[model samples]
Target: MESSSEFPTSPSSGTTAITNPGFPVSDTVLSGASLPSPPERTSSQGGGIPLSKTASNVSSHSHRQSFAENQRHPPPSPRTQRHPSFTQQAIQDLMNHPPPNRHQNPRYVGRDWRDVAVGELLQPDEVKWAELDMSIQEATKTLFQSSPNNVVLVRQDSSSKEAMSTFDHSDLNAYLLAVVGLAKPEEEQVALYRDISVKAQSQEEIPLRDLQPIFRKEELVKIPAESTLDKAIEVFGGGVHRILVTNKDSEVVGILSQLRLLEFFWNEAVNFPLIDRLYTIVLRDLQIGTQQIIAVNADAPLADALFLMSSEGLTSVAVVDNGHNVVGNISTVDVRHLTNANSLPLLKASCMHFISVILSERGVEHGRDSFPVFYVNPYSTLAHTVAKLVATQSHRMWVVESASPSPSAPATPLLQASSSLPPLSTLSPPAISPGRTGSPTPGSATVVVPPPGAITTSTPQSPSTQGPFSSVPASALPGAGLSGRLTGVVSLTDILNLFAKSSGLRPLDPSEQRARRRRSSSSSVRPTLDIGRENGRGSVDSRR
Candidate 1:
């Protein structure tokens, strides 16, 4: 909710003006090849217990009558049941007398979720590591080089065996705050902001251990490898981003992220009828995610946006124009670009320019504009949202007001079900120019202003201009067509939490400790120990 007007537009002693380059469009297009195909349905697979035809023929009237009869004479408890396995018996009971609206049940529909184990969803490659004494610059480079694995476990020193903390993109906010001198006393903070060029030079030498007060070094959530998927869901629903999987010896085995679990649900949805059905429900009907949005103006200094994210404990902030329309997005992940010495001056650039530079850098590095523009509207289906998240490899989606009018529901609610899962390429709407009234056409070229007293060039530039501080047109960007005001943000956590809630699973309270379950003596399935050690820190080479 911070406004651009609250911050000064230019430095007090310098005549250099921060010019507003039009919004840069994201050029990345999602490809379906990356998404796993939905697995074929089978009776025994995915915890599905096939019901007999006779059982399926029972009408709702008889179901209600049976419920009343059960109320009069309650059935025998599990202890007295014929089935030896309590879990099997419970699943049988659920299958025999399904809830009228299975969506309301605490268990997954058509599947015995207890059969799924936490080890099945873990990706060993995601485990990266860093040392406490490593300079922020070196750590930043390590994190960026690690790619998809955004977090790294931190050790106290090279000789230490156990990880003492964690460092991720979110921690970059604290580093940025230090660079701008915002962590200093209020009297000294103003002077630091006035001349950021001098302060940026000193930040690289600071070590990771120096920012311990602001770093999210809390104990990583741990779960036994043998634990059920439902337990993982419960922990994830509680707002934990990733959980470390451990073995009987209490050593780390692997890591499970919220995105990985969501991907599991997405790829295997066909086997779980309830989850598959839930996917068709539009975001508005489910009422998932928070509407309390934290954002910054497109013209605000990139440093200001990072400060807002750091102070508010947010991973990303929506960039909006004076009219409140979402023009761009800035997240902690983008902070990786600032670690490069040449890109450091961008801290003083406008957020819009920062986004432009990011896209340009990515376009050059990847040989294509691969940074996706992630946003959704009320009418977007849960399946669409999940697909986009997985496809873009992003953590959240900005909820924007739909440019079109709301559609009326069909006579049969089930008819609203999507015939097929929409591809990620279809999620991005057409690009529309973003800014105050009378904005340029979507095809208009980006305008870049030179530094004070710099000579202006007369040469015409291409639509896809590349530079350290130049902007690109909407036509060349992938997500430029997402037009409307941002309403809220739906993160991977929000989506996972919704699934947990619909399954009747309660979120683990902060005060409650997650009990780690041990592998049963009767089971012979032993999880493979895949934890890797490298450079005196634990790490795994990720296939992603």
Candidate 2:
């Protein structure tokens, strides 16, 4: 990595923007870009002028989170990665540091505010793919020694882009996360599947216009220009994790996140490394390693979303309406109470809830549980991905590429994880192992690995078949079918999960990536928690 002096110090200032890195960074933005006005808000959609960012702030036994909900939507691209002065050396320093430790943590002690630039150290692009595809085990045991969930991603751009995710309904998925059916007293799995049946029976899908607006730009909060991190949070309430930085024309130019702000307080041994003092990187080449986004549309038929959660396997989605603005958020937890297993057999006819249970959190062999979506720009380093989880409290983040011509960007798994995925037959649900034979899988299916091009665009009949981000089997379930162009139904939220499967969020096998790491260690700064405490802290785990 090289070094530079042009990086922006504040999250909301005029910095580079975040861009989708899935496509080549050098690739120009698709030609027809224009300012599309927000569509009209719908009836079922109530408006509170967007809640004060703090109003929606969710607090828990150990953590607290809030962000500006009404903040304007910044342009898809951020200025952080595009600044003229951002260089490779700065990016290296950012990558070397983990999220929680990047900023000189005011919550704890030790470390300097000057050296504690929260979002700097980023991983080189060459190692990015290796990091995301590593399994949870590999990420924790090898790549980073922090809580397997708290590493960060670093980028090559001098902008020092940072990313992370937040859980909308973390509790909903927690119960089913670790325990298996054998924990009878806690045997909530099957019952959980049955509860899904109840929710479906009572709700129905509606048009996008029927939702309520969550927050409007500045309606709930304000981001003072380059403001101190603490003040920013209070003004935003707690929900404003990311604040959009727009230009005089109200055109979005950049963004600031709560996680990034928090980084200002924590610091340790994390530092950037570089072979040279300066190098230029493109916007796509610089971005947060993990991204967290929320989807909500108040008018959505509760049943439709529940089915979506299970079928697509998402923890939560930031629902929106016709105008492309977020509405009241719904999460896995909302659907859980609706799909209670005890309520399933009672109704007997609620097939929707039954299948939802099978889908929401279950995996092929065993239910892997649900996770909040992490948004990524595709250009972050392995270190960035690790850091995002820690600062934002997440295990995974979704990577969004460019926006589509707008009716809405369908969540189609259009891209490939790599060129080596197995055949679609191998990916078939029925082919899944006996370990899950009795599980409440939505379609009672087993998926075998499929060929690389199994779901390519050559087959035009695949309405709703998102190219690479979200791939719905031509027929995932019996009645879960679609019509033309799949429109809003094929949302990026759910499609992102499918993309994870295709893009290799969890590599089927990563011995190779691990081997590559060993070989490159001499030249790279692979920070490890295994060594011991940094300064004033207890053992690493206890301190964190």
Best by lDDT: 1
- The regions of model 1 sitting more than 4 angstroms off are 1-111, 157-161, 184-206, 217-219, 403-482, 509-544
RMSD (Å) of each candidate, 1 decimal: 23.3, 25.5
What lDDT does each candidate get? 0.52, 0.26
User: Residue 357 lDDT in model 1?
Assistant: 57
- In model 2, the runs with Cα more than 4 Å from the true position are 1-111, 114-283, 287-397, 407-437, 440-544
> Global lDDT for candidate 2?
0.26
Q: Alpha carbon lDDT of residue 378, candidate 2?
A: 39
Tens-place lDDT digits, model 1, residues 439-525: 122212222222223454552232332334443333333323334666777887788777777788786542222111111111222
Clashes of each: 9, 123
Residue 496 lDDT in model 2? 23
